[model samples]
Target: MKKLIPISIAILFIAVIILFVMQCNVSKECAAPAGKAETPAIRADGTDLTIAYINTDTLLLNYQLSRDLNEELLKKQEDARTNLNQEARAFESEMQEFQRKLENNGFLSRDRAEREQQRLINREQELKDLNAKLSNELMVRQQEISSQLLDSITIYLKEMNLDKDYDLILSTTVGGTILHAKDGLNITGEVLDALNNRYKKKK
Candidate 1:
């Protein structure tokens, strides 16, 4: 089975959030610093613009929901592959039988031989169509799982931010746009813990 691409939810969510923040700042007539600063950037409101980051790679790997969904997907892929393989083997066996019948002159007439040949061809096409359909279904299922995971994380983050403790929350992953950030700013562990606890309660 072909491996599904890892979800890059961090990159996507971060890009959108950054754009929204920029728009908000522009509306408030807040001027961003011309250069990078060692400390957290101050917002237009004069309070410390608290920024925290979540390492999405870590979060996904540790989050139970993600792991369960991933495992389920893998199992589904395996089952699809197994079924396809079995059908393919059956088709191959039929082809071999047809070849044997042709060699042995077992067909009563040319028309019958042609009909069997056409039948085999049709079966082959059916197998190809089945393979394509299964692949597409698996891809769709993977996308749906990814969307669910993203929605869960987004909802949790929205709730977590109700207190307005962090002015900006960013997401980072390995080899992501955020190359470096302070240890204090990395809230991956805290967020992961809370998310897992919430998920546990739900189950």
Candidate 2:
């Protein structure tokens, strides 16, 4: 089976991460200078604008829900492939039998031979349709799983932020624009740990 997960799904998580981070910053007016102080950036309403970033690629890899979903999807794809292969083998056998009948004039009449040919064509079409349908269904399910994982991350961020009082929690990819930050600003490990812990409780 081809890669069950799409890179677009990772991009989708990036988009969702950005949106949630924006929500955290939306109420704040502006940012403070880098390395200004340990204190968070202050909002016009006297709120702190503590900002941190997570490595999204790392998060996706370590995130328990994502791992679980990936395994499940892989299994589903393998099963689908096995079933399709079986169907293909059966179709090939029938096709060979049809060819043999044609060559030996086993059909009682020309009309019967043509009818068998049409039937084989129709069966082949059905198998093709089935394969396409199964593939499409799996794709849809993968998308749903991706969205669900994003929702899980978003919810966990909200809960964690409530206690941590962060104003913005950004997610960065390996080669994203966020080039440098102090070790203190990287919250990926903490977030991944929390996410896994929460997932464990749920399971």
Candidate 3:
């Protein structure tokens, strides 16, 4: 009995040492991301935005649906790009002509140079403004489409919550909260599928 007692005591001590070593090797996992992970999303105008982090599916479906609905807007946006390119070529041509006239000693009268420069500047500004307007319009239309799609997804998510029996669902907003998220938890693919199905029906 005495011999058995010493053996058991030594075995128990070894087991405890092994467990301690294992615990030391792994620190406790953090509940959320650390460091730069804390950064938030913000708009160009400095508006703090929030996106309830979603899965790739959500984005994919949203893109597919919007592409379907905004076919005309998409075409128009492309046409605007074509126009910008053409306008840029025209601007370059005019600039080259002005330079050539100067090089030929057909020196532009200060007044003519000023007038030409002003015309080019004005044309450049118009092109910029037009591009900005088209970009804004496209963005607005995209947001509108996203809003409509999210409305339905939000409803489905609520429904999913009720039946799936999750204790809680967590995600960060676009910028004010939740800068990063872990994999696995991202439901983007599932969301995309749902969105695709929804659009598939609408189509």
Candidate 4:
């Protein structure tokens, strides 16, 4: 009776193995034929749909309006600089004449020379302060304009998001940092197109 029981257990084990092999074969048949399985687009985590990259080219294209804005701002700055330079030169010339008058015949009176020196020093300080104030004010104005333009860019980004259904948007231009990518991962062109559309609408 013991021998029969052992033989029965061995037969059951063999039957189980055979059934498992048959089921595996059936699964194989249900799936793709050998070596023809469809590859999954994503991993088990369910990512890797579509991603894009943009670079300096994308930014320049998307925000070309900034170029014109900068040009205008620079023109104003240059004009201001030119006018300030003219004023500085005039002040310097007047100081030179005053010094010449104070040191008549190459011999300056001690009291008169000292007074002229103090006036020149005060004028120099005034000129320095004016230059500093103008430079700071211009810098502030530039920053304000830049902030405004960036707000416009954000508005355009929102508009483009509504227009296109992109899984990921990226940049690779000189200023944009992109560490990795594959083929068709660049959406710089798409963003540029959207910016162009926005420009057109503004017109």
Candidate 5:
């Protein structure tokens, strides 16, 4: 579960980048701005297309909603682990008692002893199943949280661009497809601040 968090976050970043790219493609705004010899298309008014990027790693670290969601996930993982451990310990204690009884011939008959052993086996299987179920539930929950975060960011970006200020908004991460970008075009701080403000209001 601990390992899953970083993997999930990486996937989230990739998903966000894909979402933005799809939007740019749909709007036919993915082409390079004019003045470049290889430019594919230019605005009718001949103005340079505005572009901005958000550092997804930075956003995930500073965004209040993201931090809150991550903490929620950690809490859930911890709870599930603690519960499983308690059940396992209880089961072990019962098994030890059963072993002691069998060794001392405490059961009235062989059939009774066999029944107790079978019941323990069944209980072990039940515990295994429960562990698997909890893991699956946590995975599903992580995915839901990721989707929610992506949607929130997408909607905010769309709203921020309502004025058509940026023709393209890109998502960047450490060692991502975007290797280098001008600091001037980085809007991560602005975006993170707004997102945190909006999340606070919602809370």
Candidate 6:
């Protein structure tokens, strides 16, 4: 089975960016003269209230860091599955041997047979415990990678806006609140290029 990172984390990342922009919007609003009327679609700087949005889905699909992290996570998952399968196969082979011994009356007495049965039971429990542990470890590792990606994206946005002076930046996802937007307002391609470039530099 293919495991995936939780969608809520991605949503939360977008929410944080939106919240920051909202705060900036409020600041802009408050900065105006108290008695002054609000304008429809322009800022005080004579700019068109520079706004752009990122398509989160496209961003994740194209972002180098996200791609790398996903590949790493997938490798870890495959490794865990392979290790577990090996252990399970070994356990199954032992169980088969035990069953053959019982069929041939290889045990010296009932007590010996009972002890063998108990050992098999204990081994099964051990396998179950190991499987759970591996799953949990993978989940934790995935979450850590997700957090790192989110941090990287957030930092990049801050740096990009340092000179761009965007009045507002938004994130949009498929089936999200953003129902319609102009093609010119989509900046996913630009963000993806920047992310890949940054990742290449770090690499």
Per-model TM-score, in order, reads 0.81, 0.81, 0.49, 0.63, 0.82, 0.79
Q: Model 1 TM-score?
A: 0.81
Judged by whole-model lDDT over C-alpha atoms, candidate 6 comes out at 0.73
How much is the lDDT of residue 38 in candidate 4?
43
Off by over 4 Å in 2: 1-19, 22-49
lDDT of each: 0.72, 0.75, 0.50, 0.52, 0.75, 0.73
Candidate 4 regions exceeding 4 Å error are 1-45, 105-112, 179-183, 200-203
Residue-level lDDT tens digits of model 2 in 40-145: 4565455666678888888888787887787877777778777888888898999999999999989999999999899989998888887887788778777788
Q: Give the Å error, residue 127, model 2.
A: 1.2
Error of 4 at 113 (Å): 3.9
Candidate 6: Cα lDDT at 132:
81
Worst 10 residues of 4 by lDDT: 1-10
Candidate 3: residue 84 lDDT (0-100): 68
Candidate 4 lDDT, 30-133, residue by residue in tens:
23334533422322233333344555344553455655566666766676677678768888797878768765744357786677778778887877777776
Better of 2 and 4 by lDDT: 2
Looking at model 6, residue 45 earns an lDDT score of 43
Ten consecutive residues with minimal summed lDDT in candidate 2?
A: 1-10
- Once model 1 is optimally superposed onto the true structure by TM-score, how far is the C-alpha of residue 117 displaced, in angstroms? 0.8
lDDT of 4: 0.52
| Model 5 per-residue lDDT tens digits across residues 1-203 | 12222223433443444236423443555555556675633443455557788888888888888888878877887888888888889999999999999889899999999999999999999888888887887788788788888888888998888765677778877787678877888888999999999999999
Quote the positional error of residue 181 for candidate 5 in Å: 0.9
Q: In every candidate, how many clashes are there? A: 0, 0, 12, 6, 0, 0
Give the higher-lDDT candidate: 3 or 6: 6
Any residue pairs clashing in model 6, and if so which? Answer: none
Best to worst by TM-score, what's the order? 5, 1, 2, 6, 4, 3
Residue 119 accuracy (lDDT) in model 5: 96
Report how far residue 120 has shifted in candidate 1, in Å.
0.9
